[model samples]
Target: MTTAPSHPTDPTMNAIGQAVAEAREGDVAAARRKLLSLWSGIGVTGDPLHRCTLAHHLADLYEDPAQALAWDIRALDAAGAVTDQRVQQHHAALHIAGFFPSLHLNLADDFRRLGSFEAAAEHLNAAEESAPALPRDGYGALLRTAIRQVAEAVAQRDTAKRDTAPGRTA
Candidate 1:
């Protein structure tokens, strides 16, 4: 059996830790902004794993799910470029972010707005089917509750929108 090599502790990871701390304290926007700058300074360079991880982090910030998906694709490609077996494991473990159900739901909302009910339903079904793993703790419960509430709200809004549209059939 082959084991993945551990990532070396590095400046970039250190910066990411600091940024995450800030984000946990409700400073995500600011943390992400600083991260963007710091990341840019790293510049035109990094190992494949590093580049893939950075791309994934940036993609998480998008309010527009469609754009997020685009970034995810880039990240996936970068991850795949790594030749090391250990690196490949690292990359494979993270593939779900590109197809996360929550993100799909957001994209579904956008599709709904564009009057694409079929597409929206497809996204909604996908989101419902994808069982994204959650943390197992009080914090996880809180987050799950919040996410469910948001999903309910989105469902309600979609129903309302459909009802209000002319010639829409129940």
Candidate 2:
């Protein structure tokens, strides 16, 4: 089931929304700064759902990826703590942790570029797990595609090496 928005009438949430609107209207720095202020006030201890909402907002609005990722991890931990549904938390964390198929695929590409085929395979496998939750035609598909592509590459490399050996047949 879909979760409810954190307090429909909270002034803080309203302010955040306004700032986001302003950011969308071309005052990105101002909007982000406003979010940062509100973000600091959001204490770590509170209703898990409320924290999740705030965390999601922070993750979406923050300009710095490191900061956003920190908030995402916090949200995931809080969600896991409050609910019996561990799978949902895992899914949310994956999204927040740059595990979306596209991100994972890009990461795999970087590993491939560095000649770390094993690491690339590991990342591709992770990307595959998150693929079911990602958009079928967009980032998610890219992740699944990347996994397959990398797996094929690994297989080809292995085959090439084997074929070149004196004892191996073509």
Candidate 3:
């Protein structure tokens, strides 16, 4: 295992959490601003876990599908570079594989909104295929349910934003 500090003890992680908390507080503009500042500091080649987490949240702050898709892609790309040891260093319970379902789901949703059903289906299927890595908890259940919801929307060729989708009320 690396020498990375635990999530709460890590300064960068704490900063990311503060920004995410700001978003959860409904001050999305503030959160986006804060996260963008952090991203500038972190850069594209920063720690993969940090990149993954930051880009994932940053994607949600954008109402535009293209912008969100770009961030989502970055999140997924970062996830690919992350390791289980690095993830466990931040949170003992976190494993790198557990991040994929949500990452792919977000990408699927982004592609769906952009009217790219084929690409959306591919990522959606990847999300489902990666579901086994998800824990049997509320968060996992939520992702599973969201995957189903996204699948339904895809089947119907609906491009409108989902009311239940995380972040960015559109």
Highest-lDDT candidate? 3
Of 2 and 3, the candidate ranking higher by TM-score: 3
Give Cα-based local distance difference scores for all models: 0.50, 0.51, 0.88
Better of 1 and 3 by lDDT: 3
RMSDs, each prediction? 9.5, 12.5, 3.2
lDDT of 1 by residue, 38-81 (tens): 66875545555555555555555554546555545555556556
Choose 1 or 2, whichever is better by TM-score: 1
Number of backbone clashes in candidate 2? 0
TM-score (all chains, Cα) for each model: 0.45, 0.43, 0.94
Better of 2 and 3 by lDDT: 3
lDDT of 2 by residue, 1-170 (tens): 12223344466656766765676677767766776676677677755544554564455444443454455556555554455343243234333333344344444444554456786677677667756766545545544554676667664543122111111111
Candidate 3, lDDT over the whole model: 0.88
The lDDT of model 2 is 0.51
Error of 3 at 31 (Å): 0.7
Looking at model 1, the pairs that clash are: none
Alpha carbon lDDT at 66, candidate 1: 60
Off by over 4 Å in 2: 1-7, 10-12, 60-63, 81-170
As for model 1, its CA RMSD to the true structure in angstroms is: 9.5
